[model samples]
Target: MKTREISKRKCIGCGEMKPKKELIRIVKNKEGEVSIDKVGKKPGRGAYVCNSLECLEKGMKSRRVERSFKMKIEQEIYDKLKEEIVNE
Candidate 1:
Protein backbone atom coordinates (compact mmCIF):
# COMPACT_ATOMS: atom_id res chain seq x y z
CA MET A 1 0.00 0.00 0.00
CA LYS A 2 1.17 3.49 -0.72
CA THR A 3 2.11 5.60 2.26
CA ARG A 4 -0.17 8.52 2.95
CA GLU A 5 1.60 11.82 3.03
CA ILE A 6 1.34 14.04 6.05
CA SER A 7 0.97 17.73 5.37
CA LYS A 8 3.88 20.14 5.46
CA ARG A 9 3.92 23.74 6.66
CA LYS A 10 6.40 26.56 6.92
CA CYS A 11 7.11 28.35 10.14
CA ILE A 12 6.48 32.08 10.03
CA GLY A 13 9.00 32.56 12.81
CA CYS A 14 12.33 31.35 11.41
CA GLY A 15 11.15 30.70 7.86
CA GLU A 16 11.80 26.99 8.19
CA MET A 17 9.75 24.38 6.43
CA LYS A 18 8.56 21.55 8.64
CA PRO A 19 6.05 18.81 8.51
CA LYS A 20 2.65 19.83 9.77
CA LYS A 21 2.78 16.95 12.20
CA GLU A 22 5.99 18.27 13.65
CA LEU A 23 4.99 21.88 14.03
CA ILE A 24 2.51 23.50 16.36
CA ARG A 25 -0.57 25.01 14.74
CA ILE A 26 -2.13 28.29 15.76
CA VAL A 27 -5.54 29.12 14.46
CA LYS A 28 -8.07 31.88 14.24
CA ASN A 29 -11.44 30.26 14.36
CA LYS A 30 -14.52 31.54 12.51
CA GLU A 31 -15.59 33.42 15.58
CA GLY A 32 -12.16 35.06 15.94
CA GLU A 33 -10.90 32.79 18.69
CA VAL A 34 -7.14 32.50 18.52
CA SER A 35 -5.44 29.56 20.17
CA ILE A 36 -3.26 26.56 19.62
CA ASP A 37 -4.75 23.78 17.56
CA LYS A 38 -3.14 20.61 18.82
CA VAL A 39 -5.22 18.41 16.51
CA GLY A 40 -4.31 20.42 13.43
CA LYS A 41 -7.93 20.09 12.44
CA LYS A 42 -9.30 23.43 13.47
CA PRO A 43 -11.39 25.33 10.96
CA GLY A 44 -10.34 28.81 10.02
CA ARG A 45 -7.15 30.60 9.11
CA GLY A 46 -4.13 28.83 10.54
CA ALA A 47 -0.45 29.50 10.97
CA TYR A 48 2.43 27.20 11.85
CA VAL A 49 5.23 27.78 14.27
CA CYS A 50 8.08 25.80 15.69
CA ASN A 51 7.59 24.29 19.09
CA SER A 52 10.81 25.91 20.19
CA LEU A 53 10.78 28.90 22.48
CA GLU A 54 13.37 30.61 20.29
CA CYS A 55 11.14 30.50 17.27
CA LEU A 56 8.22 31.63 19.36
CA GLU A 57 10.28 34.53 20.58
CA LYS A 58 11.23 35.51 17.07
CA GLY A 59 7.66 35.28 15.92
CA MET A 60 6.53 37.44 18.81
CA LYS A 61 9.35 39.88 18.25
CA SER A 62 8.37 40.34 14.64
CA ARG A 63 4.64 40.10 15.25
CA ARG A 64 4.59 37.44 12.57
CA VAL A 65 1.92 35.49 14.37
CA GLU A 66 -0.36 38.52 14.54
CA ARG A 67 0.23 39.28 10.88
CA SER A 68 -0.48 35.73 9.85
CA PHE A 69 -3.60 35.50 11.97
CA LYS A 70 -4.69 38.97 10.77
CA MET A 71 -5.58 40.00 14.30
CA LYS A 72 -4.12 41.50 17.39
CA ILE A 73 -2.60 39.03 19.81
CA GLU A 74 -3.20 39.24 23.50
CA GLN A 75 -0.32 39.22 25.96
CA GLU A 76 -1.99 36.54 28.06
CA ILE A 77 -2.07 34.22 25.07
CA TYR A 78 1.60 34.75 24.41
CA ASP A 79 2.37 34.05 28.03
CA LYS A 80 0.43 30.83 27.85
CA LEU A 81 2.14 29.80 24.66
CA LYS A 82 5.48 30.61 26.17
CA GLU A 83 4.69 28.53 29.20
CA GLU A 84 3.60 25.64 27.08
CA ILE A 85 6.65 25.79 24.86
CA VAL A 86 8.95 25.99 27.81
CA ASN A 87 7.33 23.04 29.47
CA GLU A 88 7.58 21.03 26.30
Candidate 2:
Protein backbone atom coordinates (compact mmCIF):
# COMPACT_ATOMS: atom_id res chain seq x y z
CA MET A 1 0.00 0.00 0.00
CA LYS A 2 1.19 3.51 -0.76
CA THR A 3 0.89 6.29 1.76
CA ARG A 4 -0.32 9.69 0.70
CA GLU A 5 1.82 12.71 1.46
CA ILE A 6 0.17 15.66 3.13
CA SER A 7 1.12 19.15 2.05
CA LYS A 8 2.69 21.37 4.67
CA ARG A 9 3.23 25.13 4.80
CA LYS A 10 4.88 27.48 7.25
CA CYS A 11 2.82 30.20 8.83
CA ILE A 12 4.31 33.62 8.21
CA GLY A 13 3.06 34.94 11.54
CA CYS A 14 3.83 32.16 14.00
CA GLY A 15 6.61 30.51 12.01
CA GLU A 16 5.02 27.15 12.61
CA MET A 17 4.80 24.29 10.18
CA LYS A 18 1.29 23.01 9.65
CA PRO A 19 -0.84 21.28 7.07
CA LYS A 20 -1.54 23.54 4.12
CA LYS A 21 -5.28 23.19 4.51
CA GLU A 22 -5.02 24.12 8.18
CA LEU A 23 -3.69 27.56 7.28
CA ILE A 24 -5.17 30.51 5.40
CA ARG A 25 -3.60 31.56 2.13
CA ILE A 26 -3.04 35.16 1.01
CA VAL A 27 -2.18 35.59 -2.60
CA LYS A 28 -0.75 38.21 -4.93
CA ASN A 29 -1.91 37.68 -8.45
CA LYS A 30 -0.14 38.43 -11.73
CA GLU A 31 -2.01 41.71 -11.84
CA GLY A 32 -0.35 42.67 -8.52
CA GLU A 33 -3.62 42.32 -6.65
CA VAL A 34 -3.45 41.01 -3.15
CA SER A 35 -6.36 39.11 -1.61
CA ILE A 36 -7.24 36.28 0.70
CA ASP A 37 -7.34 32.96 -1.07
CA LYS A 38 -9.87 30.90 0.84
CA VAL A 39 -9.99 28.20 -1.83
CA GLY A 40 -6.17 28.13 -2.22
CA LYS A 41 -6.51 28.02 -5.98
CA LYS A 42 -5.85 31.61 -6.89
CA PRO A 43 -3.34 32.17 -9.65
CA GLY A 44 -0.50 33.89 -7.83
CA ARG A 45 2.20 33.73 -5.25
CA GLY A 46 0.78 32.65 -1.90
CA ALA A 47 1.71 33.21 1.71
CA TYR A 48 0.27 31.15 4.57
CA VAL A 49 -0.90 32.18 8.01
CA CYS A 50 -2.78 30.52 10.82
CA ASN A 51 -6.51 30.94 11.28
CA SER A 52 -6.03 32.57 14.69
CA LEU A 53 -6.23 36.30 15.30
CA GLU A 54 -3.02 36.42 17.28
CA CYS A 55 -1.12 35.09 14.33
CA LEU A 56 -2.95 37.45 12.05
CA GLU A 57 -2.12 40.42 14.25
CA LYS A 58 1.50 39.44 14.48
CA GLY A 59 1.71 39.02 10.76
CA MET A 60 0.26 42.47 10.22
CA LYS A 61 2.22 44.26 12.93
CA SER A 62 5.50 42.75 11.83
CA ARG A 63 4.88 43.05 8.11
CA ARG A 64 5.29 39.34 7.51
CA VAL A 65 2.82 39.39 4.66
CA GLU A 66 4.49 42.39 3.13
CA ARG A 67 7.87 40.71 3.31
CA SER A 68 6.52 37.50 1.88
CA PHE A 69 4.74 39.17 -0.98
CA LYS A 70 7.44 41.78 -1.49
CA MET A 71 4.84 44.53 -1.59
CA LYS A 72 2.91 46.83 0.69
CA ILE A 73 -0.21 45.37 2.21
CA GLU A 74 -3.19 47.61 2.54
CA GLN A 75 -4.93 48.01 5.89
CA GLU A 76 -8.25 47.05 4.36
CA ILE A 77 -6.84 43.74 3.21
CA TYR A 78 -5.65 42.96 6.71
CA ASP A 79 -8.99 44.00 8.16
CA LYS A 80 -10.89 41.89 5.72
CA LEU A 81 -8.66 38.91 6.43
CA LYS A 82 -9.10 39.43 10.15
CA GLU A 83 -12.86 39.52 9.77
CA GLU A 84 -12.75 36.28 7.85
CA ILE A 85 -10.53 34.66 10.47
CA VAL A 86 -12.66 35.87 13.35
CA ASN A 87 -15.84 34.74 11.65
CA GLU A 88 -14.31 31.33 11.11
Candidate 3:
Protein backbone atom coordinates (compact mmCIF):
# COMPACT_ATOMS: atom_id res chain seq x y z
CA MET A 1 0.00 0.00 0.00
CA LYS A 2 1.15 3.50 -0.77
CA THR A 3 0.82 6.35 1.66
CA ARG A 4 -0.33 9.76 0.52
CA GLU A 5 1.76 12.79 1.31
CA ILE A 6 0.19 15.73 3.06
CA SER A 7 0.80 19.16 1.66
CA LYS A 8 2.22 21.74 4.02
CA ARG A 9 2.66 25.52 3.83
CA LYS A 10 4.26 28.12 6.04
CA CYS A 11 2.08 30.84 7.38
CA ILE A 12 3.50 34.23 6.47
CA GLY A 13 2.00 35.62 9.67
CA CYS A 14 2.95 33.14 12.37
CA GLY A 15 5.75 31.52 10.37
CA GLU A 16 4.47 28.05 11.24
CA MET A 17 4.37 25.07 8.97
CA LYS A 18 0.88 23.59 8.81
CA PRO A 19 -1.35 21.60 6.54
CA LYS A 20 -2.24 23.67 3.50
CA LYS A 21 -5.94 23.31 4.02
CA GLU A 22 -5.75 24.65 7.55
CA LEU A 23 -4.47 28.05 6.44
CA ILE A 24 -6.12 30.78 4.42
CA ARG A 25 -4.78 31.62 0.98
CA ILE A 26 -4.28 35.09 -0.45
CA VAL A 27 -3.56 35.43 -4.14
CA LYS A 28 -2.22 38.04 -6.52
CA ASN A 29 -3.35 37.41 -10.03
CA LYS A 30 -1.69 38.49 -13.26
CA GLU A 31 -3.74 41.63 -13.20
CA GLY A 32 -2.02 42.54 -9.93
CA GLU A 33 -5.23 42.10 -8.01
CA VAL A 34 -5.03 40.72 -4.50
CA SER A 35 -7.86 38.87 -2.83
CA ILE A 36 -8.61 36.05 -0.44
CA ASP A 37 -8.63 32.70 -2.13
CA LYS A 38 -11.32 30.81 -0.28
CA VAL A 39 -11.26 27.86 -2.71
CA GLY A 40 -7.45 27.86 -3.12
CA LYS A 41 -7.85 27.58 -6.86
CA LYS A 42 -7.03 31.12 -7.90
CA PRO A 43 -4.28 31.11 -10.50
CA GLY A 44 -1.42 33.36 -9.45
CA ARG A 45 1.09 34.01 -6.73
CA GLY A 46 -0.24 32.84 -3.40
CA ALA A 47 0.64 33.43 0.22
CA TYR A 48 -0.68 31.65 3.31
CA VAL A 49 -1.61 32.92 6.73
CA CYS A 50 -3.02 31.23 9.80
CA ASN A 51 -6.73 31.57 10.53
CA SER A 52 -6.21 33.97 13.43
CA LEU A 53 -6.13 37.71 13.82
CA GLU A 54 -2.99 37.55 15.93
CA CYS A 55 -1.07 35.87 13.19
CA LEU A 56 -2.42 38.28 10.66
CA GLU A 57 -1.33 41.19 12.82
CA LYS A 58 2.12 39.67 13.20
CA GLY A 59 2.50 39.29 9.47
CA MET A 60 1.32 42.81 8.94
CA LYS A 61 3.70 44.18 11.56
CA SER A 62 6.64 42.31 10.08
CA ARG A 63 5.61 43.22 6.51
CA ARG A 64 5.93 39.58 5.55
CA VAL A 65 2.73 39.55 3.55
CA GLU A 66 3.76 42.61 1.62
CA ARG A 67 7.17 41.10 0.99
CA SER A 68 5.64 37.87 -0.25
CA PHE A 69 3.55 39.57 -2.89
CA LYS A 70 6.15 42.23 -3.64
CA MET A 71 3.52 44.93 -3.45
CA LYS A 72 1.87 47.37 -1.14
CA ILE A 73 -1.19 46.11 0.72
CA GLU A 74 -4.00 48.53 1.34
CA GLN A 75 -5.80 49.02 4.62
CA GLU A 76 -9.00 47.88 2.96
CA ILE A 77 -7.46 44.52 2.13
CA TYR A 78 -6.30 44.03 5.67
CA ASP A 79 -9.72 45.02 6.92
CA LYS A 80 -11.33 42.43 4.66
CA LEU A 81 -8.92 39.77 5.82
CA LYS A 82 -9.60 40.63 9.43
CA GLU A 83 -13.30 40.25 8.86
CA GLU A 84 -12.75 36.88 7.27
CA ILE A 85 -10.63 35.71 10.18
CA VAL A 86 -13.22 36.85 12.66
CA ASN A 87 -15.98 35.10 10.77
CA GLU A 88 -13.93 31.94 10.60
For candidate 1, the per-residue lDDT at 27 reads: 85
lDDT tens digits by residue: candidate 3, 1-88: 9999999999998789999999999899998888889999989999999999999999999999899999999989899889988987
Q: Judging by TM-score, tell me the better candidate of 1 and 3.
A: 3
User: Residue 56 error for model 2, in Å?
Assistant: 0.9
Q: Which pairs of residues have clashing backbones in candidate 2?
A: none
Q: Given candidate 3, what's the lDDT at residue 71?
A: 95
Per-model TM-score versus the true fold? 0.87, 0.93, 0.95
User: Mind giving the per-residue lDDT tens digits that candidate 2 earns over 1-88?
Assistant: 9999999999988999999999999899988888788899889999999989999889888998899889988898888888888887
* Local distance difference test scores for all models: 0.88, 0.90, 0.93
Regions of candidate 2 where Cα sits further than 4 Å from its true position: none
Q: Rank the candidates by lDDT, best first.
A: 3, 2, 1
Q: Where is model 1 more than 4 Å wrong at Cα?
A: 1-6
What is the lDDT for 72 in model 1? 90
Output the number of the lDDT-best candidate.
3
Error of 2 at 7 (Å): 1.0
lDDT measured at residue 6 in model 3 versus the true structure, 0 to 100 = 94
Clashes of each: 0, 0, 0
